[model samples]
Target: MKTSVILNQENLGSVLSNVKAPTYDRDKVTTSIVHIGVGNFHRSHEAYYTNELMEHFGVLDCGICGIGLLDYDRKIYNILKDQDGLYTLMIKELDGTYTAKVIGSIVEFIFAPENPFAVIEKIAHPDIKIVSLTITEGGYNLNEATGKFDFSNPVIIEDMKNPMSPKSVFGYLTQALKLRMERGVGGITIQSCDNIQGNGDVAKKALTNYVKEAAPELLSWIEENVSFPNAMVDRITPVTVAADKEILKEEFLIEDQWPVVCEPFIQWVIEDDFKAGRPAWEKVGAQFVENVVPFENMKLRLLNAGHSLLGMLGALHGYNTIDEAANDPDFEQFLKDFMDVEVTPTLGDLGDINLDKYKKSLIDRFQNIYIKDLISRICLESSAKIPIFLLPTLKQQLRNDGEITRAAFVVAAWCKYNDGVDENGNTYEIKDAMSDTLIRAAALSHKDPIAFLKIEAVFGELVNNKRFVETFTNTLNMLRINSVKLCVQKINSSSTSV
Candidate 1:
């Protein structure tokens, strides 16, 4: 596996000859953004956009400085740091073509766990104008029941007691803001690239609440200064397995520890309300809008929620990949039916989108063979995802007195999948933040049929709603009685009335 083409700063000349490298010199780019939780999604989505911004329009100052906060991030931090914050990014276009580039947008990376003090100082630095996050949906530390920051959580409680020495993101953010206040640096936007609806509001609420009790003065300062802009970020980036690493080594002769592979399609709709300055992302196809809600809703409900629908039902049908599931006639019809009948009716406020065309695009995205997006990856954190991506659809449908049979079926499939077994008795491990509780409830639901809904953290008010309960129970019973294909047909046919 040894190769002459090592992926480092010095090999830029050689790497450029093999594949695309940054057109702008690496030394010219300055860091203006400090992104927390710099995972693969961030690399392929936000980082790629920033690189485009620089390459296309010479917007070099907005380069990102990636920071790793959790203990698990130590390994990634070292890997990226060793490579001098350089890595390969390969985008697989839907039509069988590909684009490969060494992304140099991330000018620096700090392993924050190694030195929290230094990390805080870096975040508070005047050059860092924006603080973004791709910390996943669960990383916000919000309590599922209240939808607010869970101060009662141990890490929050610890941070509340000892504000100087902290643990969670809230603590670090509060401390950084405090330092910024003392240093007289202007406010910076805290953008959330996570999958939450109104993520800006969620971030503001969580950060402000944490500081409100711990340091009221900081809360006041935050209220006057900070901005959390809601954003809708999309790109299908799967986990990089060993085979992906080998593709880089053998095909490109570039030995990179963490190279990102993703779909060519990318979109970022951000609200232009940065307290400090922001990048000219619009020059490179990013939309800086007045309201991101419509876009967020469209993407979350249609794209994300539809992905969840495909995921569990796909897993149950013995199809592992999204391509496999989305290609199947029955599953595709079921997907279109769910999106059109249950989801579209609730999404009237999406402006002028051709609903049918958008739905078709979604199916095409799902069926992209190169991405090979795992239904399991889409299925991860269902307890968190259901409420964020799917439950809103359920709530809206119930409010409008609309049909929710397929929507109910989607939730029921999740409950069945939570049992850790597919229809063929092929057991797969359940992975979720609420796995312990959800897995136990999934087992109990086989007998009780309503036990899964009782997990108030995930289900919220829907747990006690009689109408939803009855409909959900019917769907679960139908799954147990009939084959998955038959049920898909029922869902598509509208024969299984609510």
Candidate 2:
């Protein structure tokens, strides 16, 4: 029997012979990018790319210093700190094979709540040229109804009042940039790696708005000094569980508290607009584009929207993982139709990418049986996800008079999913920030079929559209009376394009 050893810098030499560990001297790496929100996706994508650059291309200057802002982040903070910012990244291949690598790109971590000033100072440091973020779709603090930065958040209000002692990302950024300006540090980049379309524009809007209110005097300086670059990042990183750790120990004789598990695929298309400097990520297969909108539109509409469709329908049908749902012939055909029929019409020019192949690849990735991406993870924030992922296609289809049945079915399925009970009467907790409001609205759907659509924050004017209202109400009514599988099969069989 092989002996399991704890994962840290000291044990790097003692890890199993087959597992790849970082070759570069980690002590020599300097923190040049301060990334906020060091979640699984960030570790698997950005940090993974950076680790590659450092390990192979001799790019050690652009090491990442992770910052965790929320109280929930304390768990990751403690885990990574204990492991010396080192952890395993297990990539699950489609053919039931696995590859493991210890990522050493994250050189340090700071839990912002413990010492918010330390985070601000770290960003203010002249060496830190890029302050990147993976704060999720809702982290931008945008008002869902107005689609703009919301200043009324109590935390924002507190940060506005107590600028020096900040809580929110906007506040920390404002204070840090002010310090950098005062100390004569040159301009830096504020790159957003979130899933939102026009994420850079959103970040610029939110930060500038916060600065305009908190310290109007600094807005001009910020405009001159800060750069927000748009990026399209893709990697299906599932939440790490104890079984993941157990697998590492049992198979590889390695112990990791919080190893990241993901599919073999990864893609990052960034706009080449960093101000200070950036890693030569292109060497590691990262695409630096002149404009990321086309790529982002394709990804968000096809891949992300497809995930939401599978998630809502999967949860309703008692399918626990994405692969379980996607492998179903009925669900597979439904997803393909959703991509080819409903979403493709809304996508812009995607340069040279073969749309058909890309769509096919999405299905293949989704069907990766080894990854086991939880349906609940994809379904976690449907309230925020639907508008960004599915609604655009629905709206565009309504204008062009294209297929709306699939998209409408997704919306209806989402409403039904909020009831917190699947078709089998098995109850699962609704995991959303707006669960209460969503559940309350969904509860009214039985009486008033379009009640869930009335939440202006989520559905917008789609609730008022006669065609959409009729289609959505009919689909929602069908879902209330039938099993989710029957609904999926009916939609798949009835669609003309299929």
| Candidate closest to the true structure, highest TM-score | 2
Report lDDT per candidate. Answer: 0.86, 0.90
Candidate 2 stretches greater than 4 Å from native: 496-498
Model 1 global lDDT (CA atoms, 0 to 1): 0.86
**lDDT by residue (tens digit), candidate 1, 112-164:** 76788877888899998999988888878887777877766888888888877
* Deviation (Å) of 339 in candidate 1: 0.9
Model 1 quality (TM-score): 0.97
- True-structure RMSD for candidate 1: 1.7
